[model samples]
Target: MSYFGDIYKGIKTLLTGMSVTGKYFITARKGAITQQYPDNRETLKMFERFRGEVVMPHDENNEHRCTGCQKCEIACPNGSIEIIWDRQIDEETGKKKKMIDQHIYHLGMCTMCGLCIEACPTDAILWAQNYENSVYDRSQLTKVLNQSGSKLKAGVED
Candidate 1:
């Protein structure tokens, strides 16, 4: 009786899987599930919530919002983010302030967890919509988020 019951359950599971596959197969001609890569690159659109890569946005004046808080680095489960920062004297305040020299992001080590973006207090970092990140050399994956000569945006408090 147990053997017959087990066989019945197996058949039910198989039929359930086949039904899902058949449904997709029937609709495959009308609307294909997968897109044709390279050819449809121009028409391809990613979902809004898709996490591609971490990026720091700089404005026209070459200013960023990152205050070198290192919160993103701390939140990262893996050592993918590295903030090289130092203390500098603010010309206006005339006091020592933390400033980021370089905000490094290693794409190869990133898990696309979005933790770093959440940890940022000033909304300095965000996920870039572009998904074409493939490269031949591993060194190309390591990126400096901040542009050259980019300074902290004015009025952005730490």
Candidate 2:
């Protein structure tokens, strides 16, 4: 091709790109591609399957299904889960039983890989819908999953 032909081709390509941009600019009155995050916070919705963070759900009696199996702790790649357990004498059975003293989860250390939830045999841990995991202090990120003054429910298999 001639030098002029090459120049014409370049200009034609540039015009095609400009035309697409111009089309969008002209149609901007219809709607926007960008979301107004802060303004739309009240109506903003997340997907049902969105895995935000790990949480232990307790019943009205404050009883949880965690059996202190430590499966979640073992599955966590980032060492986010720590299950502190001890042998306690069951009042009914009068036999020593392995019970969880505390279930510590470090939100900051968690990569949200969902391995811990999947490994939970008792369905004690699940992905909560709450997406806001930010905290001002690092210490606040480490949370004890068991509620205060709560104990293992009766009849929970040892």
Candidate 3:
């Protein structure tokens, strides 16, 4: 309660804080718990469940499973997904069928929410582990999920 007593208490508290910092400083020589980012780039790995980005998986023949149902586009809160499709006549049946022209994913607008992945009925879209998504231009963030000349696999329906 006294002025000197209060001053002494403050000094003690300061010293206590300093002691913890000094302890860490001394122990840091043994091995730093903090990772040196660029140095650890080779060994660093992201977690399995980490939601980095949305991607469409394709088979060996470049055939994707996306039905272009627009579920992912609707589920996205930020409108990060855009499904561009067209009706084509199937040669076998001669029936008009919806085929995905392009599945555009805007990485810059994405919030890393897994709603799009969950909304995909055909399990077309999934979260990829590659987290580094930085780019100089915003236009570069808009990615087409399907590879060039890729097509839907046989029997994938809307």
Score residue 80 of candidate 1 by CA lDDT. 100
TM-score for predicted model 3 compared with the true structure? 0.75
Better candidate number, 2 or 3, judged by TM-score = 3
**Could you give the candidate ranking by TM-score, starting with the highest?**
1, 3, 2
User: What TM-score would each prediction reach against the true structure?
Assistant: 0.81, 0.74, 0.75
RMSD of each: 3.6, 4.3, 4.5
Best of the candidates, TM-score: 1
lDDT of 1 by residue, 1-158 (tens): 99999999999999999999999889889986788989999999888888999999999999999999999999999999999999999888999999999999999999999999999999999998899999999999999999999999998883
Q: Candidate 2, which segments miss by more than 4 Å at Cα? A: 1-35, 154-158
Each candidate's clash count? 0, 0, 0
Q: Which residue pairs show backbone clashes in model 3?
A: none
lDDT by residue for model 2 over 4-107, one digit each (tens)?
99999999999999999999999998867676777887877667778887888888899988889898999999899999999999787899988889999999
Total clashes, candidate 3?
A: 0
